[model samples]
Target: MFSMDDFYKSGEVEEDGWNLMSSGGRSNHGWRSQSSVCWVGATALCLGLLLLTVIMVAHNTSAINQWDSKYTDLIHVLTKGRDELRDERDQLKIQSSNLTQELEALRSQYNDVVDSRDKLQEDIKNLHRNRTDKSCKPGWLKFNNKCYFVSPCGTSKTWEGARKDCQQKGADLVIITTRDEMDFVKSSFAITWIGLSRHEHEDKWKWVDGTFLDGDGFWQDGEPNNSDGEEDCVELSRSATAWNDVHCNQKFSWVCED
Candidate 1:
């Protein structure tokens, strides 16, 4: 066990031991210098790595914050767009509803206009018919452009006798030619014998002029459907604007011609 002070101060030494010491000291010195250089290089490398890591972290953080801000802005823009689209859709629905209601009202008005036009056309046709013909007397009962001669004979003859009486006066029994004439005659006369008769059959009817009763001026519920077989003449009753078949010999007011 040599003391460190005695080892440095000793003047006398073995030859081989001194050489070994000197070589060892030189090697140690060299190794210490190399270690110090390596340590310095290592410290510099570590500091550079730390600085690079700090720079990368700061760059990444800035990029992340920018991306987050862009994402938030995009989301806000999309949300606003959705809200605007919803509002627009609602407005369109309201407009469509209003338009539909307006269309219904227009349809109703169009129907009403069409009905009025039809009624006007009918009136115009009636006026033309009344104005064009001269067969009917100017001031007499005019119907379908023809004049009707209501019998002036006051209730004195049978229905058949009354019709024969009218024929002798140069006009056949009263024949209804149009709705206007029929309505006018019905309004004027309380009960009068018309040109309709059911002499041959119960339901069969014929005008006094020997023509088959084909028009709608016939009575409702068919012609001459009386219970007894004696009904052979049709008379317009005063109570109802309908025809009632009665016995041909029944006493009724007579109609005369002009």
Candidate 2:
């Protein structure tokens, strides 16, 4: 709507060398100038907002990358720890196996030592028997390098009392081990107390000298039915190579040996 005539109103010039314009023209000019200033200010504000958005995006991307890096490091550390634990477990298993092998070796050595000790004991026993082969007293009979005495008939006593009497004579109740010894004792002293007995609740018989009976004892067939659950002492029978279990408190003649 503006024209050149508006700046040169009525083709006249003012006295101060300024252009004279009509009131309508001046108002239009001021409105155009204000519109241009507002447009430039709006464009500047849009550019500033765009730059701020880009800055925020860049900051967020950097933070995300940092977080990812930290997570990766944590995972690596956890994996390393797991591997170390696995190695440690394997070592413990190896140590356990080694310990088991050592224990087996020690047990083998212990068995060998036990065998050696038993042989030594047998040698010592043979040496002692050799030294005392001919050292029997008048009333004692010598057999197998040991002296034995049969209590006189009708000299019956309880098993405990018999052991006490033998102890007073520096001897103990006779221990019949071999079949020959059994035969000798059975022929010499029939129905006599021997050294075999057991505790009330025990099934194994031990001699009065604290030696356990070896192998099957010379028990009479079906004789030890533990009659009345009271028989715990062993007695030699008159029959050949047979023995019987009797009540410990029963009185009977006993054989003594040293």
Candidate 3:
């Protein structure tokens, strides 16, 4: 609230153009009085300063609001992008899990198929082994790669009849070719006709295969007397050590060798 009089008198100075008239009247001749002009100029200056401050405040507020809107929009976009990315990542993980499960199923199936194939192959191999291995028919005795069939009931037959039966069935009477064969045959049969005969020539004993039966002690002590001069069929006797020359018509069970 400083007054113009005090403002001017504090320094107590004056311009030379202004003259103090003797009649006590102002001399600086402008349109308005100095106090009136000063009041108007001060009012205008205060009003201009108020208007400038209001404009600056309005502009700054608008700028702040625009920045806030842009910031909000940017945040929304970033959040949306993150959400989409997360969703896509979750879908990818689910697909991967499904694929892994499918692959495992395929592997299990493949393994099962392989196992089945192996089992079938093993069975085939076993079948081949059974077919290829050396063996005998049912009820036949195997010895030295040959099969022998003894009469089941010890039924008797004539020598010619036994030989005919053996020949008809694709076999032959047991021939005592080796010691083991002779022992086996003699031990197995009580009395059985073998493949020995001398029907073609007298006193010249021969096997069915035309081999001469030399005197190698293959007889009992008193065997082959050729009583009645008709005994030509040789048979394994009960002594288990020799053969007996018997009449060809004698009935006895025989052994077959194949």
What is model 1's C-alpha RMSD? 14.0
RMSD per model, one decimal:
14.0, 15.6, 18.2
Q: lDDT order of candidates, best first? A: 2, 3, 1
lDDT per residue, candidate 2, 1-258, as tens digits? 878887676345552234334666798999999999999999999999999999999999999999999999999999999999999999999999999999999999999999999999999998887766668777888788778988887789999999999999999999987888877787765688899898889988898888888877777889678878888998898864688888999898888998
| lDDT for each candidate structure | 0.76, 0.86, 0.81
Write model 1 residue lDDT over 94-128, tens digit each, in one string: 99999999999999999999999999999999888
Cα lDDT tens digits for candidate 3, 1-258: 899997686545443223334223533444358778999999999999999999999998999999999999999999999999999999999999999999999999999999999999999998888655658768778887678877757588999998887777678887787877888877776888898887746768777677787656478878778888888899987675688888999899888876
* Candidate 2 residue pairs in backbone clash: none
In the predicted model 1, the residue pairs found to clash are: 136-147, 151-255, 151-256
Query: In model 2, which range of ten residues has the least summed lDDT?
Result: 11-20
Q: For each candidate, what TM-score against the reference?
A: 0.42, 0.50, 0.46
For residue 27, give model 3's deviation from the true position in Å.
Answer: 99
Q: Give, for candidate 3, the lowest lDDT window spanning 10 residues.
A: 15-24
Q: Is candidate 1 or candidate 2 better by lDDT?
A: 2
lDDT of 3 at 52: 93
